[model samples]
Target: MPQHHDPGTADAPEGQASKSGFRPTAVAAVELGVVGQSVGVTVPGASESVQVTGISLDSRTVERGDLYVALPGAARHGADFARTALEAGAVAVLTDDAGARLLALGSDIAVPVLVVAEPRSVVGRLSRLIYRSQDADLPGPSMFGVTGTNGKTTTTYFINALLQAMGKKTGLIGTIEILAGGDPIPSLLTTPESTDVHALLALMRERGLDAASMEVSSHAVSFRRVDGVVFDVVGFTNLTQDHLDLHGTMEEYYRTKAELFTAERARAAVVTVDDEWGRRLAAQTELPVTTLATIQPGSGPEADPAGPAGADWTVTDSKPRGLGTEFTLRGRNGTELRVHTGLPGAFNVSNAALALAMVLAGGADPAEVQAALDSKDPFTVAVPGRMQLVSTRPAAVVDFAHNTDALARALAAVRSPEPASKVIVVFGATGQRDQGKRPSMGATAARLADVVIVSDDDPHDEDAAAIRAEVLVGATDAKEAEQLDCKIMEVYPRDAAIREAVNLAAPEDTILIAGRGHEVWQEVKGVNLALDDRVELRNALTARGFTVLQDDGIES
Candidate 1:
């Protein structure tokens, strides 16, 4: 049996009170009425007096005196679990008016129900109220949010490393791990739910951090996972075709990402005008916008010149080297700084510049930014799955380039150097995602790689073979075009595919394993199994008696 409490007093027993921490603050007062009115449900329990300590979507995570939000999903209405949540010690339930009516008619639920229209929309405000109250007592570190279709993880890593180089205590939340100082915490999602997000921010606030960099995914933006929180700087790397399955269209996907910049709370915006979408976002956003670009030598018209003319910061004279990259950053007031990044790829130059712009916008010195870039080897802080080199003989690189645009970039980066060497790639499309991109990905891989091996990548209840067939369409097209003598192999098992690719590689060959960077688990038929691409590559290489080099010191 669960203990019931009056609206105003603490009801959980002894040690549980410390574990639960359910004391409600002033945000709850205003949120209750706003949510109640929005949903057309009269505030049933004490509105002015009632307090909710935390918000949760899962009934299993509900603690004593917490508010459980019952949202509707594709499979079922979350309100069905209201009774279970009450039994698990939930103080109240926030649901739609229709859901409340159903619950009222179904059973006599002792817990108070607050019904609102479009509960998901109002959830952001409610969560903001509940969590933002703690902002005064525990102000966040200078938080930075990075978004876009590609280069998010790499850009995030560079920013974290640069901040650390400038002698600031930093925390990171991205595709790889969550860091509080030097300790790494495993991540379950690229961007966690709003409640978890606020809780993590609260933890960082307690850790005396000076800065924090987080990856804001499209899903996070669309679902309001980052709602109610303020960002010191929000950056856009580039946008491409991905996650259309959830957003329904490219315009909607772009709009969902635009939410972060349009957000009234973002203090500054940094965008890469290398892509057209990025250029448009920079032009429309009202916040202080800084544009960056990495134009290859002798390229056509530069992507977005409007920002360089009107905006406060821009990057120019971009040149790539084998050791690192060199560029000139021009500020709005005619300030120029020669910047050298110890990271590969012309794309990385853009990522580094974005980080520099973010740090500068946050009041860090331009000289300090340059000093950070020069102080350490930029490659030292390489993200685990992004261009992560696992073998030396064939020089295999594992990256999370899942989409056509990102795939093209990764392949280009790999083939840029050693033009004579063959680029062999192993990749697969994700299940239940934008199926339109499948043939495009296949075509890209077939055109780029000397040997293309298609394998499983998070089938997730979708037919793995059918996904491969779609990818093969592009590969078939590439082969039919007579681009090169390309070999197409279908390996169902990812590990076996990796082994086969490595075994077939020569000293001059570069094998790129794409589609699952930094992820440790593979979801097949809804079950998450331990499967790391880097680990498997390393083990296979060692088993075959290959001496892997410390790092490939390749210049961009």
Candidate 2:
């Protein structure tokens, strides 16, 4: 059994100064059971009790009275930094059994030590307990979570815009920004840490917000970043090959995502059964799952119509108009409504249907959902960098499509309008992750694009050139003896590569910039430099003096 500490029992001395801006409140302590006797400790000071003000894994961010969590890494153990954490004001340490043994040799630092079976697994729970004990006290807002391999950001934007149209105050959290009451803050991760997440929720409560939409990534679920938070409704767009480096296999990745659908978290689920995995997920969960289909060919015979059956949703007769998309969303009840969205690609219709289903399942009136859809044109809340068309003459599209599945879909969507148009692609694989997908990504681009430009995308600590080489292997494998016309270029710098692709593009051609969509920074080695692909494309187009009409159809 687990025990929690009471903040009231471990009050600081009357004269002791506080370091953190947030007060050391008994409220926080009561929330996270920080008090207790030593349980299986090896260090001399293991028996001692200490009040942990906060929890942090990074030594640099540790404050006085904080408990530093030392996790083992491939290159170095967190125990290596125990001394540094102590010097930086960590009063106690939480680590594994082996780490406790190593700390016993140290005689100078006599801090309380807690030995746990697995610190990584418990870190999220501890963080949640510490920060989100009274999460219900936070204002209740209609919360929506968008999860899928692609279009999460865009779908999140659509939901936010629709909610705002209904005159509800809304906030957004995704790969682009952490928005609260319409204030935009730069984001560090797709899903923030559990502590930050609860803190944000508390802030939203303070702001009197009506609704909030978030993009939940696979990493967030796997790491339990959303452990204690409640979602009114969870929306699934689709899933594809991605993050193989973190999750060793596709099944593991799917399982990690499925964790969000458990009885404890989401009240209801809206899943897009566009892929086989989604259908399987719908079958496994007992939650009132609403199935949505956007594929033009109509629900496949293998698709479980009974799942999304009566009163469910599907997109029909989707047509891409100038800078926008027009489609008809027909519900199971036979209610047909027209929706014109600024989002590009045929995939967006599916995304819109998912958002609509989630809103309806969350108790929003179906008629209100329709009114929201009709009150405004869809392009108003376009997600930046997702299927964003920058030029008309050469028809350039900047998307976050990184995997083979997403890339293939993007290419197919762009090629649908102009079958004979020459397609040029600019893309690169991230270093230190999913190395196996490198060849697949390359092959997908080479198969679709007349010319493929391989460049660097967040090559952290790995050689950029080597990363590009792996991508080239896929391109070479894809190039058959009969089709030697497909050209491949290796450019180290991403900006240079984008410029090359733009220069190579001619009128009636399409340049597809894949990966790193809406990301404002480029991660190189260990540093994050300011870089936006959309801005770069605009600059390149301007320099080349290309006079192309901006397609406002795809939301930015």
Candidate 3:
């Protein structure tokens, strides 16, 4: 129900704009009776002339001529706020029998109440109908969705950049921000609710955008946030242990991610065969899948030139190009592409390759894609907070590496080859998340970094000291058990930890600030504190006489 409004961008209908900046300029209105019949529901005593122009789940954000969906929540039923929704100009209400009964207990509301068996299940389908996003007569943008435990945000940004490189107007939805070819809107989730998703798609069509890239998280697939939306092409970056707190296990997490590659959700898919999960997904999905094998630095013997047999495309011939890497993408029939990414790490090479392959799999002309690669260098476009280089003297970098695998990759990517150079890391596990990953993250830091400073991340409704202690447990255990030669320390007040890292660094050392990238807020006890790692790191480095680069700009 929190809206980030940017006026003068589009001519929206009166009261059509809502939270998450989804404002369609027009709505092809549908009658309430037709909507009920479409979703196999009947509205008792509903007027045939009543029309629905929009849909909303939150009562506070219901627009004029909108259908308010009152789904039951864990704490309170949405029907309890029916009066608030009706007063906000909702034309009709859609709820289940329990919601209807809850409505009956209150003062009689005159709006139409359409009763359904499961209101949440039909919210997506109904939103699509009302928004007219996928109509045969009027098509929406070419949708591209990327899903994985890692690299989703960067891959989506890469996809958008590639589309723009090919002279296409692009929109993006991800953990960073929502861009509808205009000013960027702050995002609250990886994927917004079904209503906002459909509405934003319609807005993209209205603005004449050609393509849109989205980051589809496992939570979005499980929560029905992307139910009605189907992608022209879907992409899979390698999966690892993540979001186990939500899915309960690694198998369940994989199962939730597999939902995005279904025949109903996506037309085609490009799977990265860097791990067993990606290979299994490529083999199991019914969608036409193109498998890719990107050989990074530490992939061991399995990352050969003839990467996984039957791989439709393979990335090989990688060489260092300044701070980035130049790699060749070899495909079937002796076809190849010369790719370059002006970003650090071999993982970025994988991200760039996946972006290019996904664009090609979506039916872009190969010659045009190559031309874009030559002219635009789309893969080098800066993605906020993904290996963002803040300063050069100590080589301070900020990355969104929250999990154990990501932490190891980030630490490895920033290590200096000089024997005297040390790696200083400042990180901590997020509270109210998978607590099981705390020790592993600490262990990874201890094994990879020369100095590990465990600090507080978002400690939402949890003790910050307790969270830090758990991480220190892993760091201390790894240091003692493996006899690792790393200095481990516990620090508090995250900005102080950043300053500490900069204070302990020589010009030859590299400072890696892991976790909480691009996020400007830290939640503790349900209150958001202003905290941007890039900003803090820049200020700290500047205070220490180190040169800082502009936002996400890399000079190598």
C-alpha TM-scores of all predictions: 0.87, 0.82, 0.94
Q: Give the per-residue lDDT digits (tens) of candidate 3, residues 1-556.
A: 5432221111122333444359698898899888988888765564766989999888767888999898887667888888878988999899999999999999998988889888888888998999998787997799999999889999999999999999999999989889899998777788888888999999999999999999999989988999889899999997877888899999899999999999988999999988878888999999999999886434653354444676888888999887788999989868899899998988898899999999999889888989999999988888888998887778989999999988988898899887799999999989899999999999999999999999998898999999999999999999999999999998889999999999999999999999998878788887777788988888888898888886554322
- Output the better candidate (1/2) by lDDT: 1
User: Per-residue lDDT for 1-556 in model 1, tens only?
Assistant: 4543321111222223213222122222334544455446677546634565677776655765567888776655677777777877777788887678768887787767876677777666666666562366656689899999988887888788878888888988877777867567656568766765665666676667889998999988877777777898999988889999999899999988888997575988988776678878999998888776555333533354433344556667877765357888788788777777655566767777787777887788877777766776453476778777766557778888999988887887777366578888889999988999999999888877888999989898999999998898789887888655889989879999988888887777888999997777787886777788887777777777787755633221
lDDT of 2 by residue, 1-556 (tens): 2321121111122232222222123324321134332233344443433456566665545676667777766555677678877888887778887777778766655676677887766666665555553365544567899898888888888888877777789888788777888547666678776655655665665667788899999989977678777788998877788998989999998988888887777888988876778877888976778888776444443335444433278787777676567888888888777787776666777777777777777788767767877787643465777888788788888899988888887887677366567988899998888889899898888888788999988797899999999999898888873375799889768889999998998877888888988776676776777777887887898789986445543222
TM-score preference between candidates 2 and 3, better one:
3
Candidate 1, position 537, lDDT: 79
Q: What is the C-alpha lDDT of each candidate?
A: 0.74, 0.73, 0.87
Top-lDDT structure, candidate number: 3
Clashing pairs in 3: none
TM-score of 1: 0.87
Residue 552 of model 1 has an lDDT of: 39
